[model samples]
Target: MTNHWAHPTAIIDEGASIGEGTKVWHFSHISPKTIIGEQCSLGQNVYVASNVTIGNSVKIQNNVSVYEGVILEDFVFCGPSMVFTNVRTPRSAFPRNTSEDYRPTVVKRGASIGANATVVCGVTIGEWAFVAAGAVVNRDVPAYSLVAGVPAKGMGWVCECGSTLTFRDQKSVCHDCDREYERNQDIVRKTKDV
Candidate 1:
């Protein structure tokens, strides 16, 4: 509460909940009903819409707009200019109010969304997942997966340390952390016997 910082140019609407040590930089707009946790950083020109929930230690870079129905878990990194869509198919003239029309986007704990990436709605990005720059994610991303390309396909698995997995005979090891992961049908799960 006392440690939070909001620039003079930032507009935090009434009823917005910001946690201690959080910082809102210039030209940022935090909408009413938005809940942001401690140690979070909202960079310049950022817009967090009402009903969005941003968890502790989340770093949202400049020029990003987090629309309603997006939930960012603890330690999540939203890179500069990344996009999150709430409605799967949106039309300005034809508005849909049903709950099914506005799908929620969940960014799991420790996930990192790279700069300029686009996350389509209704997809659950798993814990520690990495989305590469400029990728368009249209489906659920598994935990520890490194996804890239348009419409984002799982190219490989990544460690919790954010290093790529080196595969040998259906098993992969993390070079940085020396952790082991088992690959199964495009999903990688951590193994205990590393």
Candidate 2:
């Protein structure tokens, strides 16, 4: 197993499982019981709480705080200063003490949450979904969907290659990869035979 790089200023708590080739940068704190997969990059001042699971090749930018009960699938991109909440309703007097009160947040494989986005608890961002910068996502995002605005709404569909899908008669084609897609009930499906 290859040795992961953790800067001296970084605090990797005991019992945290950091996979090989992962780099924990300056002043980061990885809580105990957090599982970080291989080849991931945690940028400066990142905070990963316990009970968080980060998959391989994930890129977490500076100042991002991934709270407890958040699960990120492989190749997920968390932009700078993005916030993830584990508690649906938080009050100073009424502290959530049990795991049952903490809502789980799931960011599926290859999804990209843009800079400063706020991802509320108990939502699943589907595979390859693109969340625009400064957007607030309060609901479940569909796979390959491009969402923006407050309480984010689906603006359009995106290709797996991260290109916008332009439609012609309910059939959309990816500009970059030339892949074909068919729209069914607002969901885009790959039409090309792989």
Candidate 3:
């Protein structure tokens, strides 16, 4: 028997791979060939389409739909009612139903998408990046960046522990987690205390 837990109302189709300790709550549907990693939580009304890949410890809140061509790495957080689009331009008359027509979206490890955010396809959300609520992400987000507003503009940098970083001469030390960070132009990276 699988070690995962799915509520009675949840539909886990055949060929879906759910890792140990994964919990799928009410009204959730996991399509065939989808792979979800260990300790993940899929909240109510979550719909994960076929062939989607979600990594360990991912938390997908209620009303979220993860379509095909979406890859969520470990520690990713998808807040309530967040949207993910696979097709760039959708026309009902001419359907782009095939996987080749879909654009792939990769959410890197530790990235957090806030509530009601919409992530457009083909963009890479960098590791430890944070997308604020209701933001529409259309472009690639740099690592450790905090992006907000429509179309998602980079507002500041954040530590791995999710605290906002204040740089002094391009260098910052997190007060919450005591981590060090350095900013070089548009890119930010964790640095060693030396």
Candidate 4:
């Protein structure tokens, strides 16, 4: 028997790769050749395409569809109803027939996308970034950045521990985790003892 758990109602197509301790809830469908790493959670009604790659310890909430050309790294969180689009300009009359036309999207490690957010393809969401609910991201997000609003804008920065950062003199420190950061123009990087 496979080590992972799948609901009796879930449909896991043959050749789909599910890692140990992963769980697929009711009414979900995992397509063949999709690789889901260990300890991930696939909620109800989720649809995973064969070309997608999901890393370890990921949590996907209910009603999420992980389409082709999307890669989610370890510890990423996909909130309920959030989506990743494969085509930037889609039309029913001009359907994209080949994978080459699909723009790939990468959600880096430890990022959290809120419910109802839409990540446009060809963009990279950096590590530990947070996308608030209802935001539409069209560009690359820097690490620890907090992006919101339609056509998402970087409004603030967040700590890896999930706290809003307060900057002083272009430097911010996470009170919760005691992590320090230095801001340069629009980018922020963690300070290391060098």
TM-score of each: 0.91, 0.95, 0.98, 0.95
Using lDDT as the measure, what is the rank order of every candidate, best first? 3, 4, 2, 1
In terms of lDDT, the poorest run of 10 residues in model 3 is 185-194
lDDT per residue for candidate 3 within 1-194, as digits (tens), equals 99999999999999999999999999999999999999999999999999899999999999999999999999999999999999999999999999999899999999999999999999999999999999999999999999999989999998899999999999999998788888999899888543
Candidate 2: tens digits of C-alpha lDDT, residues 45-132: 9999998999999999999999988999999999999999999989989999677899999999999999999999999999889999
Top TM-score prediction, candidate number: 3
lDDT of 1: 0.91
| Top model number, lDDT | 3
In TM-score terms, candidate 1 sits at: 0.91
Query: Residue 60 of model 2: what lDDT?
Result: 100
Give the C-alpha miss distance for residue 94 in model 1, angstroms. 1.2
What's the true lDDT of residue 189 in model 4? 88
Question: How do all the candidates rank in terms of TM-score, highest first?
Answer: 3, 4, 2, 1
lDDT of 4: 0.94
Task: Report the alpha-carbon TM-score of model 2 versus the true structure.
Answer: 0.95
**What's the CA error at residue 92 for candidate 2, in Å?**
0.4
Each model's lDDT = 0.91, 0.93, 0.97, 0.94
Candidate 1 lDDT, 1-194, residue by residue in tens:
35689999999999999999999999999999999999999999999988899999999999999988899999999999999999987998999666457899999999999999999999999988999999999999999889999989988878888998877777887777788888777767788534
